[model samples]
Target: MTDGDEQVSGPAGGSGAQPADPPVTGLAAPNGGASPRRRGPLWTALALVLALLACGVPGVLLLGLVGDAAGRSAVGRKDDPATAAARRLGVRMTAQLDRQASALLGGDRTGFLAVAESAARPDLTRRYAALRALRVTVWRPVADGAPAAVDGRPGEWRLAVTVDYCFVAPDCTPSTVEIGTRWRLVGEEPRLVAVEESQAKPAGTRPWEVSDLAVAVGERTLVATTPALRAKLPRLLAQAEAAAKVADRYAVSGTPPDRYLVFYAGQAEWQRWYGGGRPKWTAGYAVGVGGGHHDVVLNAQSVSPSGMGELLRHELAHAASLPAEGYSDRSNWWLVEGLAEYAGADGQPVNRHEGLAEVRKLVRGGWDGRFDSLAPADDATDDRVGGAYGVGYLAVRHLVDRYGEQRVLDFFRAVVHEHRSLDDAADQVFGDPWPALHDECVDYLRAIAG
Candidate 1:
């Protein structure tokens, strides 16, 4: 197995090598359309991973907004002429920026041209066209970091804008990105002069930039630049199909809509998408976009041969069960991930067994973490996180082993579709509360591991 840093603590795990932290950002929006709220630990870890890459600082969300610019004036103190001019210009630019955003969302090339300078029209048109082709919609273009008046030119200003990209499907969650923009006064109006879009890909590159090639196997679409890599599509498609079947057996609301787009790339491309070098143990990730589709990327360059299929199944399970709208709470991390591992365990991959063993070692080694709180430990030692996976798998494995797969599946369905807490779901499905079930898992593990 390719084992540089990929192991399971959360999202990514294996044996011998430490598990890489999985990308927490791309899974389907847990909460589809609910009011915005703090995401659970899964997303919190993903944000940390992204921040680690972009700024070499961990714990910040992806491309942290430069800084809140609303209160600070860029030009000078409140009494300065430059400040007044900048304030007026800032208001006008904000309006024009809104118009520009509308044009981009509507795919109105002329509308974009009307707002952009002549020198920028062609590029803007091309960019808008590409975004439209990708089926990306910009919901809001809010100014984030403060706007600054250029030192010597009263006609120039720079603003940091964060645009949220809506999914083509109403059920999918939107992705937000921070971009730095420069606006210049042309003739009587302000127009876009330049955009330092951090999220913008090179020409001809797709959003993931893993590959430009594409193919379809059943409901899955595989994209890559190499024929050899593309050949692997059949295997992934098979795994996805199996994952769906396994997931359906346990599903409550039926399978989610499947975009089924998979991308094959090296570690470099994977890191690029997250905006930084991922944890050395990182291997691959699945990102859920609009339209009930998930874009899966494999670190083709890193995952071991023995692990490739297991990784695919695990991620596919996430794709299969992702809710169309809001998110699951942090307390249910074990349920969300335990089920993924369960669905993917039919192959008898060693990683699962190793993770299970890791938990035993932790218990023997004096660790006291509980399965209920098992999540990706972005900062914890590998052993602790690996134990999380180990114990998580055991918890689900015990439920299925004792309660029969149907009741456990029902439990998952209730938590996801019916929005039941883990305790509620357990009580409803098994007539036992969470504490009892947790105790059962403890007993089962002790009996077997002893």
Candidate 2:
């Protein structure tokens, strides 16, 4: 929602209501003679007007003074010299940003670096190269607000900037992020001094911004990795493309993304980038970056080559099927994770068996036959969490088996995306009440576990 319309206020006098003329103090006599009371007030008014004219103040100036006193204006006030200067600075800085964006898109390194100060050129150059390597189709930097002058620094200012960019072509839905930038005006030109995270509006760093990337592009996937994993880029891309194809089969809600953007994070990066709150056992995650676009991040050092395919499939399924607004509640965690697990374990019987192993162990422990009981705690062990995922998968699988895959997907969309009650969605999609469906799913899970 960057570059939205600015809100504007109405003109000088609020409600555009004019002030009433001063009340007539007295009436003229019927003999065509003014009363003494009226003559006295009229002379007083005339004397005040004459006094203002004697001071060399024009009638318009008199009116303006009156308006000022009344907290209104006959005409709008002009911007002060300082305010006007800052506005001009913002305009110049915006033009400079436009040039920088154009330079990055056109692959003109020299032109891109030209807008930055000498001290900033090196970092700017690195950013330019990273973005160019990513092959972003859209790069627009817009001023989020007016520039503010830096205290004690002449001709220097700071501004909040929002950048919108996209990776895929033909359906380039841009993702927007905010940045804080500093600039110094040298004569009529503005040079960028620094770019940093906006304290006012922080956003997750893009993969290119995290480190130098070894990028491999495929027809339906783009895999980016650190130089440390450059040797593994091709294998990762092949797996990701394959996973994307599998993920596309579940796109009953809409078309799959044009290209699945994947970032393979090394050990150091896994701890630093993409908001960094994932559990240690978590393999990968998908982030909805706006406009139905998503980006996948993988723990490259943690997952094995054999396990990577399933992990990719799970996250990619999320990318393909997750609604723009995301799921409504954690109560639907089963459907959320289950759908991904079902997609990941598709056509892999051994994987399915391994996934349900923990569920079987829990059933032997006399656990309650409720999916709610399978919801993992925040600090749950990896095995327990895996069991929960397995239970979710079974729930989804049961629905698919009884009703069919498309119906299951539709029911999922109704509950998660449409924010409908599970019972309501079940009644609509399956012609059964929620309790009946819930009991059926629980029975199926226990039977599968046995």
Candidate number achieving the greatest TM-score relative to the actual structure: 2
Off by over 4 Å in 1: 1-154, 158-180, 196-255, 261-265, 286-297, 322-331, 346-356, 379-384, 404-406, 413-424
lDDT of 1: 0.54
Tens-digit lDDT string for candidate 2 (5-74): 1000001100000001111111111111111223344334434544554566654121111111212321
TM-score, cand. 2 vs. native: 0.79
- Model 2 steric clash pairs: none
Each candidate's TM vs. the true structure? 0.59, 0.79
lDDT of 2: 0.65
lDDT over C-alpha atoms for residue 19 of model 1: 21
> What is the Å distance of residue 204 in model 2 from its true position?
1.0
